[model samples]
Target: MKILHTADWHLGQLFHEYDRTFEHQAFLNWLIETINSEEIEVLLVSGDVFDISNPSATSIKMLYTFLREATAQNSNLQIVITAGNHDSASRLEAPKPLLESSNIHIIGTIEKNSDGSINYEKLTIPLRNKLGEITIWCLAIPFLRMGDYPSVANASNPYSEGVTALYREAFEFAKTRMSDNQTIIAMGHMHTHHAEISDMDKTERLIMGGVECISATAFDSEMKYVALGHIHKAQRIGGKEHIRYSGSPLPMSFSERNYKHQVVIFELENEITSLKTLEIPVTIPLLRIPLKAEPLENVLVELQQLHDKNDFEQAPYLEIQVLLEEPEPALRYKIEEVLKYKNVRLARIQPYYPNKKESTSEFNQQELLHELQPVDVFTKSYQAKYSAEVPEHLMELFQQTLIDVNQTEA
Candidate 1:
């Protein structure tokens, strides 16, 4: 049986205010061709089906349309999709009854029995070949949240331990149902310990914090292949080739501009036989000018040269980085003026400044207080007291309070 593993489609994503519908559509079109050409039997989409929990109507349409078309193209192909951290479990699973009829299985959230015990049977799915023979068993586990896993009261690192425990229980149950000739595959949307993260991928870090990372040991030896999602970088965990993250189909951020996005193909001949990566063709390129920080004049010169050489239609999405001795208020305007008639679309402007270390010498407290703005002073006070940045809404309320106080004084 041939299986295609992919994740982090992030459909309905707006890349820096620019609609990525064309790019995503092109990817899906290519994927369909690949599926047909490779004669893939099972398609595993680990997670993050949409950019947000509540996706736009267009995104939802694109997802269902692709699924319907793919299944129609290859009647033998079966698809299994699990909800990622970005997905709303209920929303993703809303049409489960309809989708399953088409051989498309969706495991969005954990189900429970009437007595509140988890229904592990619902999570385990059997994958059949063209002959309708059970060839493999899939433990389709979605992103687990607090209270979603088996509870360990008073345990240290309950979240991590609970997640591991859940996988163990599911895998053990899967073992019971598996035949001697059948292979077992597991799917998850999680951050495993020691997974390499790209420098510029900020969203994943913010979403999967340090506490959420689980050890690779969580996956036992019974599993033949572990398809993972959540992380945007494609890599094998703990140097095990079978445990892999297919990564996002497209570059989600500027940090991933140089990343080679691809889908993984697993050729299972009885046991897992061969794994291959088919790199996705770049529909729209992401260009970071200067490749590194440069002076404003140098950046403008490069942009002008690039304008003369490249056509607008095929131009890459551009991000400009300028090194600065001090803050330049008109930096954006200056760059925009250069790129106004250029071929590229300006997506970001990053200003780099030299880091200045504060001295250990004594300083005047009164002078520091006098130099700070009212808002800055309040921000510092709030941070000192709470050890967190003031929330944006609270900061707005503080500004309004200042305005009211000024009016009363006047």
Candidate 2:
């Protein structure tokens, strides 16, 4: 049986205020072709089907259309999807009854029985081949939340302990169902220890002192493959090749521009499993001018070197990093003039200054409350951020804006 592991589609994502519909559609098209060509038997989407819990109607339609197309193209293909942190469990699994009829299993959240016991049947799925013979048993566990797993009262690391306990229970159940010839595979949307997250990635929650992190030992060695999501960087966890994160199809942030976004493919035959990676081609490139922050003059010179490519989706997304001695009000005009005809979409302007003071974590409540007037509050904030007093003209503008606001309220 041939199985493909992919996660973090983040469908209907808006990249830097620019609609990424074209890019996402391109990826979907490519994925359909791959499924047809590879004749993949099972497709495992670990989690994060949509960008947000409440996705736009267009995103929902895209997902359904992909599912329809995938099934129509390859009738033998089986898809199993689970919900992630960014997903609304109930919403994602609303069409479960209908989807299952077409070989699609959607497990968004834990389902309980009459007595409120976890329904292991919903979590464990059997992957059968063309001959109607069970080849592998899959533990389709979704992102675990509070109360989802068995209660581990008074445990130091309750989250990790509960997660491990759940996996063990599922693994043991899979073992009971599987024969000697069959293997067990697990899917989890979790942050495992030693997994590499993209630099400056604010999308994924940081490792808060092992509070939300679990170890690779959570999985039993009997499992053949562990498909993980939540982290956008594709990597093997704990030096083990089988336990891996397939990574996001698209770069979640500019910092992930260099990520080799790919899906993992595994072929199992006669108890031998062979795995490989299929890299997804970048539909729209992300450009960071000069590859580092530079002075406005230097950045403008480099921006001018770019040739005009006006193709809508083909035009690369750009981020400009400028080093400034002081604030330049004409910064936008300068960049726009250079990139006006370049056809590159300017996404962000990262301004950096020299002799920056690092912010401290300590908070002085008394000092904070000492600013009685709105002007004093604004002045203190401006000075703290810019490391200098607010300019006279800017201060005048601020006062005028405040006066207008006050008048409107009156």
lDDT of residue 106 for candidate 2: 93
Residues 233-329, candidate 1, lDDT per residue (tens digit)?
Answer: 9999999989999999999988888788999998885777778999999988999988889988898888887654266555688898887655566
lDDT tens per residue, model 2, 1-410:
99999999999788889998888899989899998888899999999999899999999999999999999888889999999988899999999878757889999989888998788888999999999899888999999998899877798898899999999999987888878688889999999887787764445555455587889999998888899999999999999988999999999788899999999998975443778899999999998987878999999999999988668568888989999877899999999988888968898899987745764312234466554577877776766667776889989999999999999999
Against the true structure, what is every candidate's RMSD? 5.8, 2.4
> Model 2, stretches more than 4 Å misplaced?
199-203, 206-210, 270-272, 360-366, 370-372, 392-410
Q: What lDDT does candidate 1 reach at residue 281?
A: 97
